[model samples]
Target: MTGPVSTDRASDEALAELLMRWVPQQRWFAHKSSSAHLQRLERTPLDEGGVAQLVALTVRTGLGDEATSTVYAVPLTVRHAPDEALAGALVGHLPDVDGAEAWVYDGPHDPTFTRALLSLVAAEEGAGSPAFGVHGTSADGGLPVPAGASTKVLGGEQSNTSIVVSAPQGSAEAPLIAKVFRVLSAGDNPDVVVQTALAAAGCERVPRPAGWVDGTWTDPSGATAHGHVAHLTEFLAGSQDAWRVATAAVAAGRPFSEEAGELGAATAEVHAVLARALPTEPATPERLAALADGLRARVAWACTAVPQLHEVAEAATARVDAVRHVTGAPDLQRVHGDYHLGQVLRSAERGWVLLDFEGEPLRPLAERSVPDLALRDVAGMLRSFDYAASSGAASSGAGGEGAGAWAAACCEAFLAAYAAGTGVDPREPGSAAAALLAALELDKALYEVVYEVRNRPDWAHIPLGAVRRLTSPPG
Candidate 1:
């Protein structure tokens, strides 16, 4: 029941204070529980009747005497009723600031933010300049926002924010999903680059991109503009992310044997498509050595943090060394850098559609973009199944045979489908790949341990149990 606040009249200090309290409450806030100091970096007025304001924030965390900084660009929409459908999308309640309600996100609400957002989409579709301004840079220097056919904020992603944008309205039946990069970092975002290439290569497993937006932002010194990827395309709708579906199936106690088989087959088909799309490169001794070294470093870290991972880490490192020279078909392809159940969608008609070409968030952007083994993606998916099962067990407080049975069923179904579709025998050369995957899972678990311990201490037990399972001897 509050009226709209004019962007020009709003005080930056008041906005910063509101954001500081608001950020810690978001599910995606990495340091949600930690104390933070907010500094306003930039504020841009949305063209949509000037009712919406996009504010970029640089927050410094106070850890003891040291303070570390992180930046977030949040778009806040001020409306009286807004839309009821947007209620679930609210990040936090705005302070008792007179008579206004503020809903903030990477962009405005789903289905495009007002008519102005739609206008940006139209401009991009026509290959013209964007109508909106990019924060942190002079309005004249920033890259124009791409025109979208249709747009909606992807629901259910717990990590980074994703917005799907299509070309001009009704230009084509198919639209693009331009994901705006959040938690900004230097270098080209792999997801933007690789997926575009895959689409060009006629890889059907990934959505085809119509265009992308990348530009430089002036640094604090104003000496040079650091490169950043703002958003890019290829959009789909009404598709359910695979992980959500699988988790629901398990929780409902419904057998996923058929779906697993289909998933496996779909995964194999995707590999085949990717193999055709990406260039192949030999796995040199130097590369293998580097991989081994990285694994060793991860093992060491895991051992220090989670003692249960000691045995698994040692075994995995040894196995990787053993296969260092055992070459089969050359390891070739632009892989789905961070493949997992959560990164795929199951279209009722299209089967499996992959998403987020961005590799592991912790890895350097260059490494994520480089070509790698197809098995790496396969291994990532297999680990996802394990994670899904484990998460279900933890949620329900069910352990032992019941949990094991459920996990095993899902594994069998998925593997059966993958093997039949891809023609790669899981028990043959793929075993080495599987073992390597197990090692990576351990690495992922260790990473999770640190993340959970810092962010959600209450949920730290999830990764702790995974570490125990990975290192424990088979029964």
Candidate 2:
């Protein structure tokens, strides 16, 4: 066993210098191009009982313009003796509180921090210094750490660090996944809030909610800001994401209409439960007009950004007008804003499971929390079908005609299931619902066009075809 490490040498200034150099290299760091400067704002002990002390530092990331700087939580672990096993986790050597030189590490990689973090979250609280006004709290069913359990960090995550906790081999303790937030903002993470609520309401479409770590820290202006630093929930061990499943079926030349319909029903079930378990309000005319206004601007931008959109500009404008002139739009409610195949999982035990309700990672939390049309989610999923078909056809050496037919079948089947589940058909000719669905789908495709043009120019053709199809008048 390692001896307890002291933190006397890890001064805020010294820590800041090391972190500024370290933060930019991390996969979770948002600002890659901008030079980063760290101003240490708050330090709170996440766990002091273990051999290593897990110190939590809330810092303002980015150098200039205090108002625009983003808040990030940095957890650093101090160890008396460096373990060769943790060579990849090393931060730098720093002296301990006793003036003895010690080793520091990134928290997620070190067992000291990961173990303590899960334990504290199970207890639903990490008693940080009240003087710093920061702490972590858990909900009703937070993480429970069993004996002989080990944790491994999940990789390829761009925005947060996720650790999976499980017992020794063959043990029955269901595993748990914990997400430590790298970027901090001043609102409850929607993943925690929405999934917790739905789980509490006994919705089976989403994994059961566990809990989260929340903290408060002063910003550059000396004002208090609070946000979730970490979140925990149940992990479906053998589940596969929808993207993988759909693509496989497509490559095998199998009809995915049945599975697509099932997924649509699952999505509608989640939507229904969310409306019942959370807040909802009528979509006021002002809100509809504002949404239409945004769509108009996007339409214009899409035309300019993707020159191919010029051919469909008039049709796109007509759809936007339909949105603006609609009466009795669907009631507004909290929705899975970033609904795509990637945001869901397919479990053998549970038909279809949802994940990541936090919406678009790039959008502000406040903006994402606003109620929106459910068709927006419908639009996103429909686009995912198209993506799956394209990928599947390419992989299986099928003609483009086969890919288009598969996507269209999936679209029809999914929409039919959704209409049956919700008791509201969105495809009624000349109806406001029909018009809005087309507009939202066009908007999603247009956004995709911009993205593909910038990131994957060859892929622009996919969304451009969608724009033409969606904007064209019904035959």
Q: Please report, as a residue range, the 10-residue window in candidate 2 with the lowest summed lDDT.
A: 1-10
* Model 2: colliding residue pairs: 6-97, 8-97
TM-score of each: 0.72, 0.91
Candidate 2 residues 1-475, lDDT tens each? 1223333435655666666778778887777766666655455456554333433344444445632466677777766788888899888876543455567788888767777777666665555544343444566654455555688898888888888877778987778887887777778888888998998888988877666777777655667777777887888999998999999988999999999999999989988988898898887888888889999899999899878788889989888867888886778888999999888899999989998888887789898887788889999999999999998888999888999999999999999999988865777887777878888998999999998998899888888888888877688
Q: What is the lDDT of residue 325 in candidate 2?
A: 84
- The digit string of per-residue lDDT tens for model 1 on 1-475 reads 1122344334555567766777777655656656877643555554534445555566777686775665555666544444666676555455432245554433446454433433444344211113223422111222233443355665665546666555576554455454555555556676766665566666677765544444333333333333343444445568888888877766767666787777777677767776776666777767666766776777677667756556566664564455454444346577777888888888766778888888886565667767776667766776677667766666666664565677678767877777677765553534555555555566666777766776787767767776667666544
CA lDDT of each prediction against the hidden true structure: 0.59, 0.78
Error of 2 at 405 (Å): 0.8
User: What C-alpha lDDT, on a 0 to 100 scale, does residue 389 get in candidate 2?
Assistant: 94
lDDT of 1 at 251: 71
Top model by lDDT, which number?
2
